[model samples]
Target: MRKLIPLLLLVVHHFASAQTKDERVKIDSILSVYTGRSVDGKGLLQEAITLSQQSDDYLLGQLYFKLAEEHLATGAYDSAGKYYPLSLTPLEIAGDSTLLGEAYIGMGYVLYLKGDYTQSLNYNLKAEKIFRAAKANKLLGRALKRMAGVFIAMKDYGTSEKYLSEALTIAEEEFDTINIVRTLNTLSVIYDETGDFKKVDPILKRAIALAEAIHCIRCMAISYSQWGISLHFRGQYKEAIGKYRKEYELNKLEGLTFDQYFVYQNIAEAYFELQNLTLALAYSDSAMFLAKTENAPQFIHDSYKIQYKIYKAQNNLGKALAALEMKSQYVDTLFSQEKARMQEDMKVAYETEKKEQLITLLEKENTIKVLEAEQSKQLRLYLIVVVVLLVLAAGVLFSRYRLKQRTAKLLDAKNIDLQNLNQVKDRLFAIISHDLKSPLSSFHTVTSTLNQYYGQISQADIKKYLEKLEVASKSLEDQMKNLLEWSLHQISERKLSPEVFDLKEMAETLKSFFQLSLEVKRQNMYLEIEGSIPLETDREYVQTILRNLISNAIKFTPPEGTIWLRAKTAGAEIVIEIEDTGIGIASEDFSKLFTLEADKKSIGNSPEKGTGLGLVLVKEMIEKMGGTISLASELNKGTTFTLKMTGKQQKQAA
Candidate 1:
């Protein structure tokens, strides 16, 4: 019976192992969809997460880890933080040491981003231990590299260098091109920051070569950006701008919005160094815009400082002072002492209130004692006085207690308000930064080119350059006008003026406005109207909406892609759809497509510049005019935006 039992158990173990292998294949298939394309897979991800939960398998941990990675990529740190622990729990329970190590690495990344370097390091160290025990060199290199970043952040450069060197050695041995590129770039940064400029370029060159060999756009971008920084450090402003522009173009192709600010700011600084104040100012504006979108206080601060320099160089004292003021305000936000002072004052007030209350009670007690001594024969009178004093004291104490509670509540509310204000400030900064960049970049490119080629060029070439400059200047002017209108709409509540206008005529006007942009991309647009479907809506608001929508379509749609503006009337509604064969939005982005709360920006097919505030404004205007907006998109396929508004004057129907 015992021998039979042992045989049966062995058979069950073999079956379970086979079952796990089968499960892994299925899980891997699902994971491929996530890792393969830039499509919206939030729904698929959630469904997979549900299936993982139901199965109660080791795949649950992997699903959680992938979800966490997705969140981390999107800068959703809180969501990433929540999922990392779930990953760790299941991996540990299943005794999957390999995945368990990855979970630690995931947690470490989340904590690092949250600015908890010590805790992040702990997680990375735990991951290192697991990877080392399993002899997983690939993952061990990643953990070691992450640990290097933690140490760098903690200012232990020696330890960081050591870890980085170890990671580099492992990456080389494993022939891990990606890790090799990463390690090399990081080492270059460390050396550059430490003023070992001689060593930086060679390291960056190697990183770039490796990155290029693998066709890794992100790694190449990083290397080029670092190269620009090294040049900027040495006052080689023109060369630095060249490198920075290279980085910017690569990042744009990859739609890496988060990293663009650094390149933009570096370009601005380069122009500033060259004493090309106009171009410097423009690039500074661009940098500030990108920085604001990211809510990166440091970048915003740097941008303002550059702006101040530009203005000062141009002898624009007023603008320089304004820039200085703006820079100072951001500095205050970055390192504000006001909250600490407020807390200290509150503490002092509470203590003083308590002391005052105690002193009052003691005074009352002394008064009662005196009365009792003086009125020994008049015991009733003394008792009456004592009772009155006791009642008054009780009333005062109750009032003070209520007041203190209110004070505490008020302080708590104020703190919450302050936190919310900081968030708003960050978003507002992003918006301002974004709006300032497009026109600025356009202006800078033109002016810089003209300055470079002016006297040395033929008259014909000069004329061409002048014409380009004129076009750029006009574009900048239009951008400024749009900025003014946007600012006015946001700053005050204005009544909308609705009128019956020729929808076809309005479309023609918009077509003219975006003609240059369309020609640039060689995109085709067709306006298809079943009838003259004119509506009574705010003319300016409708124009704004149509302008932004059409512009966006043109921006996103690749060269030779088609766009259709179709409108029809159904029941009491005029339905309009802007359809584009464009690089469509990912499904995960749908939730915030029209939300002003999200600083959502993506590069267009033109690699065009946009603040992302336009869509937000469009939604607000539509809602105000009692209209609805909806979108249908398939990534790399197409996007369709549908707008429905109440039909105006049924009697005047075409």
Candidate 2:
């Protein structure tokens, strides 16, 4: 039994080692799934981190390294920063210099995302030394490329180009298609920024071809994004939008959230440049939505800025102000983030300095004083930033106040114009009423006198009364002509001139004449002239019909309702329709409408009394003009009057 015990221990120890190896394999499998872009790296890494913490394994460093990279790829800089150092701890403990160097590269990327170019450069330099020590040429090239990106972001074009040129050489020698294409895209961007557009397209083209040849979606997305940027810089906004759309579609299909966010941001800018405010705002919202999820403060800031611009372009000042406020919030957040990062770095420096000074008793006393000075400096800087943001916010609010004041003044001017129009309408109506009443009253008196004295008088007296009636009738006719001329300028003094006229123009004229009436009722009028309308009847008759139809529409229509004057050409006939969203005629009133019966009277919505003779007159006139008129109405709904007239109708009558 004692001899078998050693065998059992040996077996158990072997199984434990095998189990650890299997766990490591599982971790690598999970990482492979994430790196292959099959699933979200951040989620899978979180699970891996949990499992790694539960077990002591040699793969822990690699897991932490991959987790940090996932965070970096998602633009979670702070999280990446934390994870990168954690990764370095396990790698250093395991004596894996290769992974430790990779962790440094990840940290460099985090710092780059945080906008600390100098610190990122320092980290990249350290990574380069580690890679060179391990004789990893490809990795060394990667570090160089990263340094170039930092320089590009810093606007040090010469230094960026120098680094990129070296990286490209290494990438070509190593047959690294990804890095080769990426470096080309980056160089294109630098050239584009330098306004060397002529040099930009060729470089981008090469990158695109290589990326396509390699079937690398990420490379293609990067090249397409840079191409879009170059086109955008050249003022080809629509073309840029097309390129950006390709990038967006590719990134979406690949589930690359960061790439999609960048594409959306670029698309927003392109649309904004094209003066397409709606599309710009839509893309900006998408960018903001993605940026929020990724914790990408810079992209979030950019999204708000684009939204603000779009709102301003649309003349939506209130919304623009709101967007501006949001932009300011993000700006403040980014500033705080940068400030906090700087403070963290300084604290690290202070701690390192304190440790070094403690080794030398002479420098230890001054270390506390130095820390106090740094802390005081940071406090003053925070106060200054707060005050500056407050002042900026005050400026934005004051601009909003000024905009409101201008809007109020503009509204006041519009009101004055409306009041003047109303006054003109009143005066015109007064003149029309007086002219009509005088002629009407004279005709009535003459007829009444003749009727009463006919039996008592002789034939000569009757003839004299008849002559007086004739003069009164002529006078009434002249006054009616004047009124018609004043109301309808289309009416000629000699005779009714019927000719083909633009139906839209006639409708427009009618709309203008009834503009005041429409305004008074708070109603809207629309003209829907489908095509050319050539009427065969007299223009005066058409005008009179329309005037009566429009006046009745206004009187019957309630406040905030609509009236439509529509005309369309139907083969040999021109069909005109006047529709009103108003209180409609009753079923019984339909029969009485065209008849001169005692019941043919209606009080409109405004209590406007009418003899209902308009429709009767219209029907008679339509028949005389060789045309037809029809009416459709519903109770409390609306009314539609349609007229079918043709040039052939007049020819047939002739």
Instruction: Highest TM-score: give the candidate number.
Output: 1
Q: Indicate the TM-score of model 2.
A: 0.43
Full-model lDDT for every candidate: 0.73, 0.70
lDDT of predicted model 2: 0.70
Pairs in steric clash, model 1: 40-587, 286-437, 288-433, 289-433, 289-434, 292-430, 293-430
Tell me the lDDT of model 1 at 18: 53
Off by over 4 Å in 2: 1-60, 248-265, 276-304, 325-654
lDDT of 2 by residue, 309-349 (tens): 68767867557657765765675576567656645534543
Query: What is residue 141's positional error in candidate 2, in angstroms?
Result: 1.5
Per-residue C-alpha lDDT of model 1 across residues 233-298, encoded as one tens digit per residue = 777888889999999999999999868887877787788778887787787788888889878776
